[model samples]
Target: MSTKRQLAQQLGVVVGFDDPQAALEQYRTPPAVASHLIHLADLNDDLDGRTVVDLGCGTGMLALGGALRGATRVIGVDIDPGPLETARENRRRVGTKTAVSWLRADATQVPLCPDEPVTAVMNPPFGAQTGNEHADRAFLGTAADIADVSYSIHNEGSVDFVEAFAEDNDGTVTAAYQSSFDLPRQFEFHDADSRTIDIELFRIEWA
Candidate 1:
């Protein structure tokens, strides 16, 4: 059996969100985003023994990557159960020695440990939904609330959006990187006709 298939079997059945295939179809992480995350984590000297959170952690790619990079503990959080199940299965398949945990919860209302500092990485929804502006704002607001320092992914065109987020929370963008990604057919709203989508990865710190 393929590794992914074997993982699905070992994880039993997922509830809430659709099965693995559906989840993959609708919510796969873009390769550029993944690469940027890994690069940012590698550049940070504090990641070796720190706790990190992967918000909107579809399939745990970021979380697993963090573990491989020597984080003391990596937590993957998502609202949907299917993605959580897939993340757990991926964790098992990779078989890393670093600690990894998956939590099924809304990203906007993450329950965090009060005493420990956390570094978070997230690729939040980019307000592409026709009428879901509020959802996207809430997601960003929650991200700022939960971490000491954060690296967030957003569309390159969202300069105003990012600036507003930083302004609202007394944070500043310490660094930014650009990544280009292909839009998957499942997310047709992205509407790239053979063109790569430009995305920005911003390192944010509160003032």
Candidate 2:
């Protein structure tokens, strides 16, 4: 547990975007959340000998954690270039030769390699911003199409919607964990220094 906490702290040292785009709903997943989810994946044997993708992988927390935990291959896809640059720097800092790939592509459009079974972990947009509403559906839909199993975080208020979406895609929620997602003040929208959002971590298996 101490090692895991240390890893999370190292990953968090990389700064997130200085100017986060609201249209993309860019918020970095907290270090604790990333560590907790990665530990759960390790227990499930999802990190070994598997190809993993981190959708909207801001600063590469989930992707790097997967690599550090022994995933054979990990891919991180993000639409924003700012965070992707930061993620690459973090990768070098981690110093793993795990064949991690970073792509500057939208999560919904990231292509999967045909020969490998893919598992995805993501903290997609909560769709709170005016134009980005329901954007989580796009990431979920893409994951359902490409991955055998997926772990994603969603707003607590959207549990029903997430369940229905999973069912619609021939997927089932095998496990769900609840936690508080920290949203720090990034943009100047006249908000507090930080706020916590109730969130659910979902583990889904695709049929």
Candidate 3:
């Protein structure tokens, strides 16, 4: 089994969006964070021989991570075709034998119905932008519809919302960990050249 650090190194080649849309909160998920979450999911025996789907999969960091580890198949869904193109380039950059598919569709509305066990990995928008509050709820709803289990990254102090949503949807919060998102000044609104935001990772089992 590849350690987290090794997985990070493997995912280091993933490229970020060429032109990020502030409305979408598009950003490259840090290799370290992606590696840690994927590694944690692997530890839970959630990935191997399973269909792993990455929602809002900017440049395919998490999706590619799953492929590198031992997932039988990986599908990355995103609304932007630009990032999907970059994700295709990234697949070749991080050479692997596992099958991977990139679909240009909204994460919240992707038409996917996998027949095998499914695991979702997503770094969705935190709804920091105007008119987008509670954006993660749509993603969670889609996850509940598609995946058997999911690992998601969210803004800090999301436990109550996650837990309540889980309960309402016949799911359970199986595990949680504190993590950080290393963000860069890719958009005009960013005040600093770089910032590290404290975040939380949750593992939920959907029924």
Candidate 4:
């Protein structure tokens, strides 16, 4: 029941680097987009009283948003230590009492508690950068391995790929939402101030 503005307020207060390593694929998820994805997952009745994992969580947008949205527990996992530091700071700033845990580890390698039904939400790399192809596949495959339901983001062009990937991993795409993903020029790769890419939020449920 949180408003987008309210969610943004909670996430926008935190700060992060505009661009980080391409291997990490660390584009900060926009506040509105993070809110929308989390909202959609909540609408699907997938979050309340559940342990929510924010894989590749950058700056804690999805983690903090899920905490704010009444999740029973929230774990923000990332391979990079920098963003995980930022996530800790953001967690302290938000002051959410939802049993939040920040773990610095690869999303595909993170350990899950046994007998706990987990749900994952992430805005992973779209695999556009050099040497980073099929990055989203790892995240989706890991979610399929450990999560009951997952909400993930991908480029519009990868719609067919995502669907097939989900099906192949014992999950089904129950829903997909399209939105304009704003990409600010962060890296030194000659570009404009910002650009918008068509992105899709896919809701995948384990079969």
Residue pairs that clash (backbone atoms under 3 angstroms), model 2:
none
Per TM-score, what order, best first? 3, 4, 2, 1
TM-scores for the candidates:
0.80, 0.93, 0.98, 0.95
- What TM-score number comes out for model 3? 0.98
Off by over 4 Å in 3: none
Better of 1 and 3 by TM-score: 3
Over 149-197, each residue of candidate 2 has an lDDT whose tens digit, in order, gives: 8999888877788889999999998898998976888777838998888
lDDT of 4: 0.85
Better candidate by lDDT, 1 or 4: 4
Q: Name the weakest run of 10 consecutive residues (lDDT summed) in model 3.
A: 181-190
Model 3 over residues 129-170: C-alpha lDDT tens digits?
A: 999998998999889999999999999999999999999999
For model 2, the superposed segments whose C-alpha errors exceed 4 Å read 1-4
CA shift of 130, model 3, Å: 0.8
Query: Per-residue lDDT for 1-207 in model 4, tens only?
Result: 778777877777767754487667678888888889888878878889798999999888898889988899999998888888888888889888889989888888778753687889999988888888888999998898889999998888778998999888888989988997778877788379999989989999986
Winner by lDDT:
3
Candidate 3 clash pair list: none
True-vs-predicted CA distance for residue 27, candidate 2, Å: 1.6
TM-score of 1: 0.80
Of 3 and 4, the candidate ahead on lDDT is: 3
Q: Give the TM-score of candidate 2.
A: 0.93
Q: What is candidate 3's CA lDDT for residue 130? A: 91
Q: How high is the lDDT of residue 146 in model 2? A: 86
Q: Rate residue 18 of model 4 by lDDT.
A: 47
